[model samples]
Target: MSTEPIDGAALLDEVEAFHRRFNVFPTEAAYVAVTLWDAHAHLLDCFDSTPRLAFLSPEPGSGKTRALEIVEILVPQPMMAVNASAAALFRAASGAEGRPTILFDEIDTVFGPKAGDNEELRGFLNAGHRRSGVTYRCVGDGATQNVVAFPSYCAVAMGGLGHLPDTILTRSVIIRMRRRARNEKVEPFRARVHEKQGHALRDRLARWTEAARPLVDGVFPEMPEGVTDRPADVWEPLIAVADAAGGAWPARARAACLELVNASKTDDKGSIGIRLLTDLRDHVLNGIDRLPTVAILERLHSLDEAPWADMGGKPLDARGLSKLLRQYVTADNEPVAARNIKTGGGVLKGYYAADLSDAWARYCPPPPESPLLPLPPLPASSQP
Candidate 1:
């Protein structure tokens, strides 16, 4: 190792390079965010909150575990919490030795179908985001039992098979991992050989963070436009670290923040009601004014990638769809309801386009631009 002091920007560059050597992230933004996260773990005391770094994928062999393993070596007091009980996690994080940087692999098993209720564990993950966050627990037995508060503030990174609970998801920097293509290649990580190199980088990060503490503590870095609310909280520390690092990092960090934040909005797998409204706007409505109940159900069920075909273990019928949309209102403040429409043979119950306009605008993004929209007719003055 060099005897000289560490350069923050150059050290971050080295950390990014180290990750690239062993892991293939889905986007350039993903790599940038991960790099900043690794650096921020060393200086958790300087910030008010620590965003959980989540690596999630739909299928197996997408490198979720490898990402956590790589992070395990680079953080302070790394603790792997797979299958750990809630009480165990609380004790480990609140220990006097130091708050462990919790690395949770196979996290899906904690929240999956087979797993029993894990409300306490979930609460721990949620509350730990803020510096003052804590969990209240009753300890002792009989007359001695008393409630106590345990500090839940700690840096956590998780790798899981599917989505996290909404409470945890809002506080996380979500990386949607994908399987590598045939053309993409990465170095095989061998803990025995590569861990030493990772540790060296980790030590350098520690030194840099020590030097940066005075500059970053209580400093709120300027956020990119449109990044507000929970997202602003989640990205604040990472952006502050980037700003302190100087060089091209401040700009790069802001860009990464914008890209990843916007991507999360578009990629959110929202509630079923919201999904139904979105699907109707994008797939069923088109340019037509109204769709009969039967016709609407047909289009929704035919979608191969949608859950309408098997929602609640059966196809979503008109009654269910009506119940879902009943909560939403029209422009006139009337609950969205099915009205009768006259057809060639008889009057049929269906939804009108005007009634759904408000819900579509409020609950979903504007429909994608379609090429099939007809062009305006030639103006009268210009007509030949």
Candidate 2:
């Protein structure tokens, strides 16, 4: 290493510039988030948790794999894998050489429906977020068998089609990739020429991280409004790195944090129960105070392109709806169960609008604000 001083902020600028040269990220925030994530990996020992970097999209050729390839050249001891098993990952993560920066491509193959169950790998991904996280396994044979705890903590990045499990998704800085448009352009990544450049930047990042680690180790940078809990934990290290760098990065980091976090909120597909609640608020309720069970079912079944129309080859029945909603509570903290509602001739089993309020408020996005229309022109005679 050189004995000269390093300018942390300028070094980060170079890293960000390098990414822009090869990758057309979805937004400016994606660039900032990925840059900070690269720097944070070098300072992993300074923080209690490291957020997983996830690049996901609905289709192929959207640069998901390219994003991981870029990350591979920037981080320390990069271990790139595809279709790797849990046993293999565990061995790699616990290798004596130190925790490798695990970059997984085609991660959907490990967690997607066609791949079947991978509980061990899922558990590893979840536990690895925190410093103290570990997994136990039986070692040795028969008489000599002993349960040993293996360290699961490591910096992880993944690229794949579609979504990850909710456990992993919540702990990640997700970049939703999209195919480049006709006019959009980026340099074709040629490893022969670019690998050396990326490696050079990687070296500078490592040097800067060593010098700045002491300053950022325990620093608690302020979070933007509405950023708290798991999102706060996921962003803490990245923001801390930006703070140490100084210059425009501090403001840029916070802005990116808020933007990405809020975007995740909007993009969240949510559970089926939550989806039902949102549909009820947007469709069936329509300002009515109450609705009969049969009436609600009719409206739900009539929705085109909705799962309710052909759920397991049948329309959503009252039993299924009840089962889904029963897990939630009402405004009064009572079970959201159907009760007797009086009709002209007799009573019918139905739901009160009041009972669904709590679930709707908690699970659904706020209604969109109507665009303010300009007031009609004042009458010619009335104009002063």
lDDT of 2: 0.90
Inter-residue clash pairs, candidate 2: none
lDDT per residue, candidate 1, 7-48, as tens digits? 899999999999999899999999999999999999999999
Give the poorly placed runs of model 1, Cα more than 4 Å off.
1-5, 114-117, 285-295, 326-358, 370-384
RMSD, every candidate, angstroms: 3.4, 3.3
Stretches off by above 4 angstroms in model 2 are 142-145, 302-306, 310-315, 331-333, 344-348, 370-384
Query: Tens digits of per-residue lDDT for model 2 on 1-384?
Result: 587978999999999998998898999999999999999999988999999999999999999888998999999999999988777887788889998999999999988867766899999988889988887889999999999988988999999988888889999999999999998889989999999999999999999999998989988889888899999999999999999999999999999999999999888756778778877887888689888899999999988756787876898999998998899899889889988989886898888878999988887878656668889999999999
What C-alpha lDDT values do all the predictions have?
Answer: 0.91, 0.90
**How do all models score by TM-score?**
0.85, 0.89
C-alpha RMSD between model 1 and the true structure = 3.4
What's model 2's lDDT at 313?
80
